[model samples]
Target chain A: MRRREALLHIGSWMVTGAAALSAGRARAARAAPLDQPSVRATIDNLFPDLPIDTSDAVAIEGPEITDDGAHVPVRLRLGTQRDTPHRIALVASANPHPLVATLDLGERFSGPLALRIKLARSQSVILLAATGQRLYAATTFLKIVASGCNPGQDETPPTDLGTIRFRHDPPREGMADARLLIRHPMRVEQRDASDIVSRPANHITMINVDIDGNPLLGMACGQSVAADPYLAFRLRTPQAGETLEIGWRDTQGRGGDARFPLGI
Target chain B: MSLDRRDALKAGAALALSSLLPACATPLRTPPTGRVVVVGAGWGGATTARYLRRWAPSVEVTVVEPARAFVSCPQSNLVLSGGRNLASLTLDYGRWAADNGIRLVRDTVRDIDPERRRVQLAGGGQLEYDRLVLSPGVDFDYAAVPGLEGEAAQARVPHAWKAGPQTAALRARLEAMPDGGVFVMTIPAAPYRCPPGPYERASLVATYLARHKPRAKLIVLDANPDIISKKGLFRAAWRELYPTLIEYRPSNAVLQVDTDRLTVRSEFEDLRADVLNVIPPQRAGDIARRAGALGEGERWARVNFIDYRAERVDGIHVIGDATLSTPAPKSGHVANQQGKVLAAALADHFAGRDPYRDPVLSNTCYSFVSNDEAFNVAAVYRVAEGGKGLRLADGSSGVSQARSSEEAALARAWATNIWSDMLG
Candidate 1:
């Protein structure tokens, strides 16, 4: 996804080079696939064998620009087509640590899902949906005013660090979706350790999910997680003697736990 | 103390196109005519609507606002201090709707279709316009202070930043406080609604607690490194007025909040209070940000200073506190002036003439240090190099040299004049 490679890729496909070139950097920006080298490399590394197809049916719906990079609201919409995607992933090209989120759309999962994610700087936010063997992408550029960060780690001190709330769907066909709202600034400290002014990188680092006295899963978040992070995942419907609990630890090593009792 | 500070600040600043007669620009002036959609009926949106009616009658206008009443943020702190009642700060928009010949739609703009020039309403249906003016105020960012958001959380720790039931709720909670109880309030970083606002609130609350709850103490937890606005005056007033009761803590960022225990956790310390007022960070209103007007990394809308148009969208303009109009404090006076200037700019543009690229706008903010004494600051912002937004007219802004009763009266008068201009 180097600039030269992107230009060559643009020459092979997409809108006419003349029209894109006439747009004045439009070819490099809008028309070029994989404008971001690292993001493209990551995707290629993840699914090197899978073919990625560009589709207009996939849309990254959010503001064209936002004043705050900490919590940019976006919605992932998939076309009402047969064999819809089973997984969705979002990446911010300019984010310090891309790969904002990777979610599995489990059985009974449906429609456009809403999200609020953090961005390190101004850049195109790429949304990729994987269905069958192809990856569909939709991107929109955001211009940031004052930059904020949640680098790759969080170091927020464990003090009244917000609260944790959750919403769990009633079991349908032995599967339920759980949305966890963990409150944290998800601040990203500057990579340069010698910087004087401490830009508070108070982001959440780890979340542990325990259901029915068994460990469910864990998420290792980066700077791309929004403030007061809201995350969704799927879990098996609790059976006899099952207890559901969730816990999270922020970068500052502060943590909280919550329990959802069994359904009668 | 003197208006001369403002007058002196603008000396030798290059202010281009301060006087541009539409007639002179175009001899054959086509009467301006087009539909203008305005969202939020606060001082900024309301003033734009009224002025458009006055200056450009033919331009059809419709304002979309969810709230039925206009709450004045400028004086809500007075309500906390008992200098004014909530009723005085709240004004009904009925008169504005009745007199302005503008269609007032009582609805929220859920989405904006920039290409289609249409705004989808929350309840349903769409309002199409040739131009859209967004003045939705600010929305609180509560990630930094967790477990203290939403209705249930707000019920416990009332920010009272917005003027309405929250303000009344905080007042009632304060009134119910025991004389020996501890009241704590936290201020977020800068680029918030008003520069000197948190201090004004701190000052007003200090005055109230000292008089009624004499034995009680108030803690001012400020996240910023220093007092942001009118520092000298606020510092002096705090030292002279309620030195014992008010403890000003600077650079103290509230890391977390535990509502169950009513405690605030910050770096190096933890404070428990009977009444906690946490003013969390804020960003542009949800709908305004959805319009893609605000830039990334910042929380307010970025606009062309000349016309207040959103940089991302062609015919949409954003004003008020939700805008990132730096070098210009987010005050009522600045928003109102931006509205008038934008109104004229749109009028002239519709008349087939270009709006000046680098127009000048001024802001005069008066903050009450007490019920009788106040301090004021004023400045003019001109378009920066290459018409890039605005910068303070060099040396043109200053905080008042002193606080006085006359300035306090002027502060009250300022509210009446601005209210009339928006609603009369």
Candidate 2:
């Protein structure tokens, strides 16, 4: 019954312009009030009242139809060469929690921000980006069909959680390419070997990267990040011998950090 | 994801009207008259040359290919099981260019002078063009495996990745092997031409062994972590049909090869077999290297995906299996689609107009699992907003739900249609 109300709220929110903004503002602007508190908090911080118009500036790249709904590879480029987006947010309307992730992608980092996310089902995946004052958006519909194998099929989770691996190239053209793979199941509800249902809902909540004590990138992941979440991004002006630190915390209150000594 | 007949006519009319307008200051070619020289007569090059003639008859199109007949690599695997012969797959370009008013040169291109926009032919000649298309396909990186570097070694254990002599030799070797002998085939990592090709070859070979040898075993060594394409269908087909005859080992990249011993060694173990098929890692053919298309240490040519133009060189576009098109597997279908798109882009360029901003490309590849059953994987791509690369079009890509004899018939039809599309 509550799902119906949430659907109606989302429908009204879909209507753009001053009417929808004001209507959404009156309703507390909760994109996914039914989701977890952390996810809801992140959604609230996204300024849902802001108007979003479709623009070609943003690029949301992924498979049109995916067999594995458990993990869908998505690459997001917030803005084009003419426009530099200061922040970007992803929302999948069909997910229990529409808000997937939000990243503070500063103006300097223009390369594609690639990561994997879990889709509940076929839905429209929306990318919202803010360049200067105006907010722009792009939407790509993704269809998730049942795998010919089992549904929710995923690679075996790494035995050790929070194990992070980094692969990066030396600075090129004032930017450095880096890839990160964090070991976490990003588990959804599943039946255990004991025939008992388990819903841990443990997933990476926050991702922080620092280079020599300076913040390089920050991201907040919701329940939708995929298993052993993989991320690839470009860092601006990374130098040799500099220490790069990556830290993440999951919903279970467990946290882990790793440090890499950059080399040429 | 195709332009209809009306759309093609509209584009042609636009070209005609635009050609009447005053020439833009930065036209791609001066005076709007252009010559296009396409190297190789494979799927991509032939399609490009043919479509270029149709789209813009004023632009001279010349195709320089070494082979007399275009042997298709798509359906060549059936040769192993005697389902299809090499002769049946070999398509003749009989006066295709002459009838279309294009030039067809039977020669090899040794080097590409991008600055001068000329290609040096091995038969002691040079062809100058306003634009050059290099669709030379893939060349095996035999040096990556030490023992398989020399010609004699390759002849001893044929890769048969290409569709000509090596394919025939490998088929003969399979027929000659004694009963109960093991046939070992190695699959290179992803980004190779035709992702499902090695598996299809393995399946047909298994079928041959099942019927003729009966006691023989086939081992597939895959470099990838798992089945990369048509995974479910291939696995199910293997389990249902070739249960006892085939063994698949994933993540088994070839570390070394002992051609004389009929052995291949991966990081995990070494296997000796009656037949060793070492499908080595591949890169853009040598002509692309001569054109400075591939970057240092890169295996494939980097192109400006919009028009398939080489990143480092101007007036030279590299297509086909030789290019690195991420998310778009290297295949003849993709090359043919790229050929049409590049042809249209060239037409727009010569007409002093901007190339179509949103270009769509679709690829459909069929893999025959046995003599009578097959499956397919299809994808549709559109130019990304910024035009860096192609993104899968919304809700337009997937694999066949199941394998069937119907799809096998469709596979043959696809081949017949595409062959005519490229060479007709």
Candidate 3:
């Protein structure tokens, strides 16, 4: 009788363990949606006519969990092909605006394009890649434990733009790196802590880089860029004593330009 | 070598005495030694350099600053309302360097030799150091706005974004305008320095108009549909204090500024103003890019919270306006706190001591809504893992929920405290 009772007890324990395991699996299966419907609609509306082929060729690399959502490091990689990919775009479904960044390779670049994206809340991001009329894509959901969208209580009206200076990275022969600095209170439009209705978005919209009177790169940016945006890119042919001109424009129609001599 | 009986007895006696004096022999306190070269002498760089010297006296510290004086951005907003003079806000770094034994070099940094651990000054002097600290502030992107350039900024318009002579120039322009003249201040999009700064300037300008020139209305043309920070407080204060003097129009994107005609052209309409405070969009300090600190299309440096070191490079530390520190707004308070934390970490490294773990930092920013009232926000941060950065401690950082009468008074007090902390 005692042996029979012990067997029954062991059997009950096994049954309970199996039940907990199944419960955990069920929770994992019910993964939260990464992209909201509104964000998906925006993505679709932006590219209405094109047939977006959702495939694994394009991957969005982001942390499964992010501590700060304001400036998340997002890397978009396209599949290695015999030729360069035709079009690559990045869309953050959870941001106030769906399209965070868009890049057209223009038949020249091949390596992965890395940029930072702003997240209003924790949401999944999708990377869409097009190669030779074929669209391939992948998605990664980032669980943002902290919200970067609403500075919440961290907003301080900056009193100083501070001192401006230029420094080059890897001061080597043939290769040079540079960054431009400015100071302003970069206020996003979505915060409502002051009980004011919705705040308007004020951000830098355009950046133009000219080397020796020739335009090297031009871009149109939005609030998705972090405060004190630090734009960096590689110059394939850096020659010493050449002049590098940079200019920036804000939505307010106010801008400034600086000329720095390249010390290659 | 053989020792005689007498000599052996003496040696044994000496060894016994050494064992007894264990406390005196406790590992010679060899304070760690190193060199830290800091670029830019703003709140971030200044505090970091100061703390580094205080924490590690043996470490040689040098700060490269081109500016002879440091005028704080925190309290400069009061200048628009005629509350303070530029001289009151300006600071000198001579005391910090001389008294603290930090080598203050007044020279522009041309380039950073990360490999050789040296910095090339603009004057052709190469200074070698083990660690480099960069806190150079932001730069403006002029091409974003058409018809706004160098001559336009100097003669016709003023961004006054960098507080100093330009800030004084802007105030002079506003005061010189006629009583009924229009004061136009354009707000940039997100991710600029001081989120509420533009609004504060607008409020101060409106205040000026309310008392001296009631007919001279302040028009705030913002790019976004909403104000960035303290919108409720600002709107409430404006409505109550200077209702007729201030008009805020959201989403009125200024396409360009015609300095000659004194008109700001927006996407929807064109408005004429006597004074145009066109705050332009901005980017990271140029030094970060020169040092290859930022990622592709990244306008800020990627830094590790452990030591505020650049994630891309090993021996370089990037702080202040250049780092891409999310969750923490780009404010002088945050920069100063980061400098202190980095100083402690550097000291630990030099002394062969285990670095202090999990530093807690605090930041509080006060925006004066009126001469009598101000809005305040404060937070405490801690480093978290998983490639993610700092996280705010619960119940540590928050905004004044209702803008209580007492809270406004406290805000002013906080402002005074911050200035003292940064400069004093």
lDDT of 2 by residue, A161-229 (tens): 787877666667787777777778776545478845454455777777777876666677766777676
Per-candidate DockQ values are: 0.03, 0.03, 0.03
Clashes of 2: 0
Order the candidates by TM-score, highest first — what do you get? 3, 2, 1
**What docking tier does model 2 reach?**
incorrect
* Candidate with the greatest lDDT versus the true structure: 2
Candidate 3 all-Cα RMSD: 18.7
Tell how far residue A28 is off in model 3, in angstroms.
8.7
Each model's lDDT: 0.71, 0.75, 0.66
Candidate 2 Cα misplacement greater than 4 A, ranges: A1-151, A154-264, B1-32
lDDT of 2 by residue, B172-283 (tens): 9999999999999999866688888988998999989999999999999886545777888998999999999999876456778888888887744579999888888888
Can you write out model 3's per-residue Cα lDDT over A111-151, one digit (the tens) per residue? 45545567777666777665666666677876665566664
Model 3 stretches with alpha carbons more than 4 Å out: A1-120, A127-264, B1-32, B151-155, B401-416
Give the range of the ten consecutive residues with the poorest summed lDDT in model 3 chain B. Answer: B19-28
User: Candidate 3: global Cα-lDDT?
Assistant: 0.66
lDDT (tens digit, per residue) of candidate 3 on B1-424: 1123225335434533443332322321454378789998887988787667666777888899999888888768778888778887787764656655678899999998889888999999989889898898887777777878777454567787788988888888878989999998888765678878888788788767777787897889886546767677777877787878888865455778888888887643579988888888777898887887887877778888878888887688888777766566788888988988899999998988866678877666778765556776767788878434877787676665644556556554445554445444
* Candidate 1 residue spans exceeding 4 A from truth: A1-264, B1-32, B295-297
Q: Which scores higher on lDDT, 1 or 3? A: 1
For residues A1-264, write the lDDT of model 1, one tens digit per residue.
532243223222211222222223323344354655544654664445667777687887775454556656677776563656665657766554565655444334444666577776667878777777777878777655435464534354335465666555556777555555665666655545664335545556556566654545444455577766665444455554666677776556677898766542
**Second chain only: TM-score per model?**
0.91, 0.92, 0.87
